[model samples]
Structures are given as C-alpha cells and as structure tokens.
Target chain A: MLSEKHLPAFYALGALLLIILPWILTAADSSYLISTATRLVIFAIGAVSLDLLIGYTGLVSFGHAAFFGVGAYVVGILAFHNFEETTFLGFDGTLTGLIVLPLAILISALFALIIGALALRTKGVYFIMITLSFGQMLFFLFVSLEAYGGDDGMMMFEGRNILPAIDLNDRITFYYFCLAIFTAFFLFCHRLVRSKFGRVLAAIRQNEDRMTSIGIRPYSAKLLIFVIAGAGAGLAGALMANHTEFVSPGLTHWTKSGDLMIVVILGGIGTLIGPVMGAFVFLLLEEFLPIIFHELGMDLLKEHWRVVFGPILILIVLFAKTGLYGLIFKKEG
Target chain B: MTQLFFEQLLNGLQLGMFLFLVSAGLTLVFGFMNIINLAHGSLFMIGAYAVAVLTNLTGSFFLGLLLSFPVVAAFALVIELLIIRPLYHRDHLDQVLATFGLILFFNEGVSIVFGRTPLFLNVPEALSGAVQITDTFSYPLYRIAIITVGLMVAAILWFIIVKTRTGMRIRAGTTNPEMIRALGVNIQALNTTIFVVGALFAGLAGGLSGPLTSVEVGMGENLLILSFVCIVIGGIGSIRGALLGALTVGLVDTLGRAFLPDLLGQFLDPATANGIGAALSSMSVYLLMIIVLIFKPTGLFPVARAA
Candidate 1:
C-alpha cells in the first residue's frame, strides 16, 4: 500500500485534478463530463460512508440506500410542495439548502437510529436480511405514494436548492460544490478511522467478544457509526436529487445499496480514498463501456454491458481481493 | 365481504406456497452449505423462462414443467461447480457479492436472450377454469393446483428428510458434515445433491407460478426478497421455520394489500386513509419481520447446529 506519509500528496493531487476537471472538460467542449463527475463525487460520498460501516466497523448494512433515498425524498418532497404552494404537515416547503440539508441529515440519522436499534440485534446473514427488509419497506412505501408520482418517480421543476454564494443551477458550480462535500466527508472519514473511536470499531470488527470483555460494548459504537454513515449518505442523496432533478423509489431500492457496496469494494474497502477512486472508475466504466462496445461492432454487448460488467465484478470479488486501489498502490517489501 | 375475505385467504395461501417452494431450497442451502445464494432467484427466473419457452414449443404446459426441472438442475450443477464450490470457505460478504454478481449476469443474460417484453404462459386447459369449493365460493383451478403441489412437495421433502435413508444422511450432514465425511460419505457430492434439489424446487415454483404471474426477466427478484424475508423470519437453517415464515409473509402481504385501504377508511377519511393504507400495507411484512426479529432474533425456529 501507499506509505502513510505520502498519502497527503496523493490527496492533494486528486484534489487539484478534481478542481480543474470541469474547466478542462469545458475547454475540450466535453461539458457532459461535468455532470458525470458530479455523479461520481456524489456516489463517492455514499461509498465513503458505507466504507466506514462495512470496512471500518465491519457492519455490512445491505439497506443503506434507505438513507440515501430518505435524503433525496426530503429534497424532492420539499421542492414538490414548494412548487405546488402547499403546506405539508403545517410547514411550508422551502428550497433553501441551509434548511433542507440539515433536515435531510437529521431525518436520515434518526432513521438509522431506529433501524440500527432493531437490526443491530442480529448478526451475520440475519442482519443483512433485516436491513434489506427495511430497505424494501421504504422502497415500496415510496412506490405506493401516488402523490409523488408513485412508481414513475417525481421531477423537481422548481430546480435546485438555494445556497448562499453558490449558484447550484450552474452545472460547473454544482460539480465543484459536490466535490467540496466529497472532500469534507472523505477527510472526516479518514480522521474518523484513525481516531480512538475508530480503533474501538476496528477492534470490535476483529473480535467482538474480546472487545466486550474489555468493557467496550460493540452495540453503541456500531450504532453511532451507523448513524454517522447514514447521515453522510443522506447528504449525498440530497446532492443526487439536485444533480438529477428527479427522485424515485429506485433511489432507495436494495440494488442501489448493492451498487454502493460494489463501489466501496471495487475501490478498496477500509480505505477512504479508495472508494473515491472506485467511484471514478465505476461511473467511467458505466459511461464508456457501452460506447467502447459499440465502437468494437459488438452491438449486442453494447446494450447488455452488464453481461460483461457482471463477470468483471465477479472476477474482482474472486481475485482482486485488495481492489483497484490496493492493486495500484501495492505494499512495498 | 365474507366471500371476498375467503377468496383473499386462498390467494394468500397460493402465494405462500410459492414462497415455500423458493425458500425451502434457500434455507437448506443456507443451513447445509452455509452459503447465501442471491442467484437462487436467477434459477427461479430461468425455470420460468425454460417452462415458458418449452411450453410454447411443445404446446403442452405440463410437458414444459416436467422438462424445466432437469434444465434448471443442469444449470444448477454448473453453477455449483464453477461459482459456489469455491465460495464455501469464503465469508458471507464474499458469497453475497459473488452471488449478487451472478444475479446481474443471469438477469441481463435472460433479458438478452428472451428480450425485455414479459412472456405470458397460459394456464393449462384442464386447470384454467375455477373450482367450486362451496356453493358461494369458487377459486381458480390453477391456484388450487399450485397449493396442492406445494403441499405435496413439502410432504415429500418431509418424508425424505425424516423417513428415508438419504434424508437421514442429509440431516446428519447438516448437523455434522465432518462426522459424515469421516464415516466415508462423499460430503461434496451430498452438498451438490442438496444444491441441485433446491434448484429443482425453485424451478418448479417458477414454472408453476408462470401462468399466474408474467414470466419476465426480473420476475424472480421481488419474490426473491420476499423469500429472504421468509427465511429470516423462519430462522436460518430450519425447514419448519421456513414453512411458517413463508406462509406468514405471504398471508400478511396479500391480505394487507387486499384489505388495508378499506380497513383504514373505516377510521379516517377515505382519500387520506387510502394513501396511508397503501404505504403501510406495502410495509406490513417488513414491519412483521422487524417485530419478529425483536422478539426472536434467531427466527421462529432456528436450527441449533446451524447457529
């Protein structure tokens, strides 16, 4: 792996490139890359948070997209009501990021608290199923809501949230805004996994019984991180809603949770920057693989890229145990 | 209203039978092999597709159903050798990821081969009409046939597991694979047998349900999660638990969707109640699962050795 002391230089290089990517894309007249980068950054945020839970804490929550959807729905619902000039539960809808962002975080964190309290009681396959069950419940709940477009999903015509000093309606501006958020969360997770609390979580993952014998209850620490991860995912969700201008039950589907997990694992679990890199690689593959297939005259493969993508994923799980990051930054002898 | 209630109950039973067929194999795989096979759903889908294509070709649904068993079993055998055999020693996370990858490949592969348009399998002529259970109540003949077959399978499985020598060996294997291996039994072959049998049942369920539900690319996925709910609620590694859990989930899901709106309308205005009821009913099974886990974390009938 990359040496500990050189990690900051890698981070600086990544940051510098991300900062100039949109401008470079614009110069190339490939402004669509900005939106793509925005999606990558947003998902990177989600992947980083998931890494904290699955990698650092060793809690493989299969239902994490619930928080992501919850955050998007907060933004989506508020934007919908704001457009309709209606009050939802005696509160007028507002599009201010200052209000909506915090609300999204708080609500998603609360969701994690309730779900964590119940699901944390189970371990191994049971925990995975219970979390998936809750995620499905939330997905069906959203799908059943006819007022929000139900199975078809809802679009925000009123546009992105209002933030002070940032015009998020501009694609480049939003890309930078999302990059900033990703950087903040990425750094937060980096610090968190190194802290004393992080060590406890690591210990709990390594051997819960030993941790329990040492008087550190695994439940509370796990719950705490679950909430934190949920909150971070919620922030990413809100950004996702703004980026797409659409929200649907699909956002909360268990498959979305699976995708987030794939991102983490593909990037290299337990490493903050790995998921960030994984996000970049994942979206790039999603974007370019079909075009590449089309260029190669494999029209059938182009439309069914997942046929190729799936085996690649399987091979990664089977052979690339350390992931793309670990492969690139091989540990020195 | 009573008639409607009875009809919905039968519908729930039929749904439960499907859940049982799928979850039985899943629970067995989890119990014996200690693997979480998400691609089990893909097997169900292939079964549906197999039966659909064969039925269309042979002009006989029963023939198609009979043939799908071997087809799905063959596919299962291949999967066992290539993907699952290596995964036995890996952790649950790896199994989940690999199987999840398998789901993608299978779903997309089916879509590529079969096209995205949903396939419709006609109910075989003999079972197409309704059966008069009572003067006032009639149910689809096909549905009743499904329930009967499900029960028969359950009984046969019980007999095999409880009475027959093979069943005893299977049970012994579940409880103590190493001991069975020490006794000169081919444990790997035994595992393969259980895996293929499980796939056969899942295939059977898919072929049976094809007529009632549209045969589609991802048809197995929704049912897959519901079966997972059944397995979780029933307790991992317990066949009896799987049955109870499957029936409970099926009945609750079907009945909740059928009656929740009207039930809630009685207490509140129709419009608001309908909306909330729709959401709540959709969530009812998950709520049931959460409540069950709260009370019995190991599931209703958790197997001792598996735990």
Candidate 2:
C-alpha cells in the first residue's frame, strides 16, 4: 500500500508541474492548453471541496453545485450590473476580486448552512435527495432570473475580476492566479484533514452511533464541515466565472455536481491531491478523446464521445475501486 | 376561470400518473435491491423512443405502446443481469455512479441513433378527440386515457404486491433477503422479475405520454428527478406512498405554474410577478419535498423494515 510518507513528494511534484506548465505549453505553441489547464485547476478546487464531504465525512451530498453556482452568479450578476451601470438590490457592481471573492464565499456558506440544517436531519438516501432538491431549486431560481439572462446565462463584458498587481487578462497571469489559489486551498485542506476536527469527522463516518455515545454530537461537526466545503466550492466558482467569463444556471445542475463527484472518485476519494490529479485526467480525456476518435476514422463517434466515456466511467466504478491516485501510488491494498 | 382551473387540474393528474409510473419502479428498486438506479430514466427514455418508432412502423399507437412494454422489459432484463445484479451488494455511492454512467451512455447512445432532433407522434386515432365535460370545457381523450391506464396499473400493481404469492416473497425479500434466500427461494430470479415489472411501468408511462410531449433525448431526466422527489415525499418503499407523493408533487407543480403568476399579478406588477412566479413554481415541488422531509424524515408513507 501507498505510504503517507511519500505523499509530500507527490504533492511537490504536482505543484512544480503546475507552476511550470504555462511555459511548457507556450514553448510548444499550444498556449491554448493554458485555458484548459486553468479550468482543470478550478474544477480541482471544486472536486477537492467535495472530497471533504464524501471522503472524510461520508456525506454524499448531490447538491454541492448550488454553492459553486451561487459563487459564479455572484460574480456574473455583479459584472452584469457593472456593465449596465445599474445597482443590484441597491449595491453598485464591482469587478474587484478582493471584495467579490469573499462575498461569494460568505453567501455560499450561508446557503450551505440553511441547506445543511434542513438536510442533515435526514440520513443516508434522504439526505442525498434533499440536497439534490435544494440544488435543483437553486438551478431553477437562476433559470428564472431574466434580468441576468436566465436560461441563456450572462457574460462578463468588462473581463476578469480586477486583482491588485495581477493582470488577469493575460492567460499566463490568470493561470498563475488560479494556480496560486488552488495551492493555498490544497495546503489548507491537507492540514485540515490531519487536524483533530478532521479525525472526528473520519470517526463519525465510520460509526456515528459510537461518536454519539462518546458525547460528541455529529450534527454540528458535519454541518461545520459542510459550510467549509461550500465556502471552498464558492471560491472555486468565483474563479470559474472569471475563467469562463460567463455564468449560467447549468453550473448548478445536479449533473455538474455529479461531474465533481466523478472527478473526486477518479483521483482517490480521501486524498486531497487525488481530486487535483483526477481533474487533470478528466479534462485531458474530455479534450482529447474526441480528437482521438476522429483520428481513428470514427467521425460519427467524435460528437458522441460521451457514449464511450460513460462506459469508461462504469468500468472504473466496477473495477478501478481505488481510483487513479491509488492505481499509480499504492503498492498494494 | 373555472374551466381553465379544471383543465389545469387534469393536467396535474396526468402528470401525477407519469410520476407514479416512474417512481414506482425507482422506489421498488431502491427499497428491495438497496440500489439507487439513476439510469432508470434511461429505461423510461427508451420506452418513449420504442413507442415512437414502432407506432410509425405499425401505423397504430396502441400496438406500438403494447410492443414497448416487452422491449423495455427485455432491456431491463439485460441490464439487471449484467449490471444491476453485481451492484446489489455494493454501496449506494457505487450504485449511483454506475447508474449515472448508464444514464450518460443511454442518452448519448440514443442521440447517436435517433439524431438530436426530437421525434413526435400523433395521438392514436381512437383517442384523438376530446371528451366534453361541460358546455365550455372539453378535456383531451388521450390525456384521460393516460390517467385511466395509470390508475389501472396502480390497481394491478397493488394486487400483485399485496395479494399474490410473488408479492409475499417480494415483501419478505425487502425485509430479510438472506432469510428469504435460505428459505429455498430463487432470490436472483425474483429480483430480476421485480426489476422487469418496474421497467414495464416506466415504459408504459413513456409510451402513453409520448404523444402528449416531444419524444426526445434526456426527456426522462427531468421526470426522473420529479419522481425522485415523489419517492422522497411519499416514502421510499411504499406503493401507496409513491401514489400520494406523485399526486401531490404533480398537483403542486402544475397548479403552481398555472396560477402562481396570475395570483401574484393581483398584487404585484406583471413582469416581476411573472418572473418570481415562474421561479417559485419551478421550485415548488422541491420545496414541498424539503418541507415534507423536514416534518417526516422517513416520508409520508414509509414502509416498515425497508432495506
């Protein structure tokens, strides 16, 4: 089995690659790769936050995209108002990331608190369904916001959020900006999982009744982690809105939540770095699978790549029980 | 206004029937097999596609609908043996992931074969006309037929589940699968049978409702989520719960959309009212599910000894 001792090396290697990737892609005249790289990093952030719930706490929340969407919409809606020179709920729009990012995190945390409070009352499948419903509720809410473009979504006209001393419009700069945020979150989550609170979460996942018997109420601990995860996802969402330069209700869909889960599982559920690796692999497959199909004279299959991808996902779940991180790093189970 | 209200009520009932058909299968699978089959929607989607193609081929919507049951059953049988059987012992997370993959496969596969454009069917000639309920209002015969079929299926399902030998074993399996297996019953075959039956109902709903809506890729997904909400509201394993939950969700959703905007317009400006109403109505069923779950976490009609 993989030893935890080697994880620091893996983390260092992964971070080094990310740091140097822009130069490598630019050197190869594949600077477009930076765009995809940025997305993968942003999604890695979302996937890692999800891992906190699914892996550490054993809460398989299916509505996680709600926070992610809320964060993106916070940026998108603010940018929309800035473009129109109007106020949203009496506040003038601002493109400043310093303000928008924190606001996004705060609002998403609030959403998580409300949803978690109601949803935590139910256990197992009921919790999953309630969270899914809440996510769908948020999705539909955004879809009905005609002022912000509704189903079609809204775009940022003024470009990416303005950060002090950061030129976000430059691809490499934005890529580095995203990379820096991802690194900070990655380290924070790493420390968090080793903390006393994190051990308690792991204990709760194993035996909630036992945890309760020991005088620790699982609800507050679980709810706290849920809020933290939501805040993290919201930060990712804010970055995503800037990266894509647009926001839509689709971001909050249950399918998006599913995608984040898939990424986490693809890497290795419990490992924070696993989701980041999973994001790298997933985005690569999405980018190149269609091209690979077309090269093999399966032009019809190019657009229908999901037909192939779906079975791959099934096979992974069925057989690759430990995911990619475990596949590469673990010597044995 | 009364006529419009009546028509919307029927619409709600019609939608409720669809929800029951889908949720009946979902709840049974979840209850008995201890699996959450996200691809149950794919089976429903296939049923609609089957009806569309067969109806066009045979020139009779009824014949098409009848044939779709067997087609969907066969599909369900294959899926159960190859995929679901292996997952029966797995955790909910694994089952969810696998079935979600199946959804993507089936959706993309359908689109590849049928093309992205949605297929449509005309209502069967026999039920094409409307039945007059009053001087000012007439309800579509096809919709009424859907409701009748839904109720009939519910009755038949109730009989099979409550009165028959098979029903006895199913109830036993849900509570104590190991004991049932030890009791000399072929649990594998029993599981397959239940899965096929569930798939049949979903297919029947798809075929019957195909003409009322466009037969398109991913159509079953929206209905699947709604039915999931119904299952959550009604109680996961109880057929009676599924019925109550389905009807409540269908009614709330339809009525909310139909009258919420106008009702709001009475007090607010039309534009804002319409926007808020549309948003709220879309969320109404979910809100209802949340409220119900908050009050009765087990659902309104939870089955005792559910897996």
What would the TM-score be for candidate 1 when compared with the true structure? 0.98
Candidate 1 lDDT, A1-333, residue by residue in tens: 566567779889989999999889989999888889899999999999999989898888999999999999999999999999998899998899999999999999999999999999998889999999999989998998899999989999989999999999999899989998888888888889999999999999999999999898999999999999999999999999999999999999888999998898999988888898888999999999999999999999899999988889888998888887787686545
TM-score of chain A of each: 0.98, 0.98
lDDT of each: 0.91, 0.92
DockQ in order: 0.81, 0.89
Against the hidden reference, what TM-scores do the models get?
0.98, 0.98
**Residue B215 lDDT (model 1):** 93
Candidate 2 chain A, run of 10 with poorest lDDT: A324-333
lDDT of 2 by residue, A1-333 (tens): 557678778778878988999989989999988999999889999999999999899999999999999999999998988889999889999899899989999999999999999999999999889989999999999999999999999999899999899999888899999999998998899999999999999999999999999999999999999999999999999999999999999999999999998998888898888888888999999999999999999998899999998899999998998798778776444
Residue pairs whose backbone atoms clash in candidate 1: A1-A330, A1-A331
Cα displacement (Å) at residue A231, model 2: 0.7
Tens-place lDDT per residue, model 1, B242-299, is 8899999999999999999999999999999999999999999999999999999989
Stretches > 4 Å off in candidate 1: A1-5, A331-333
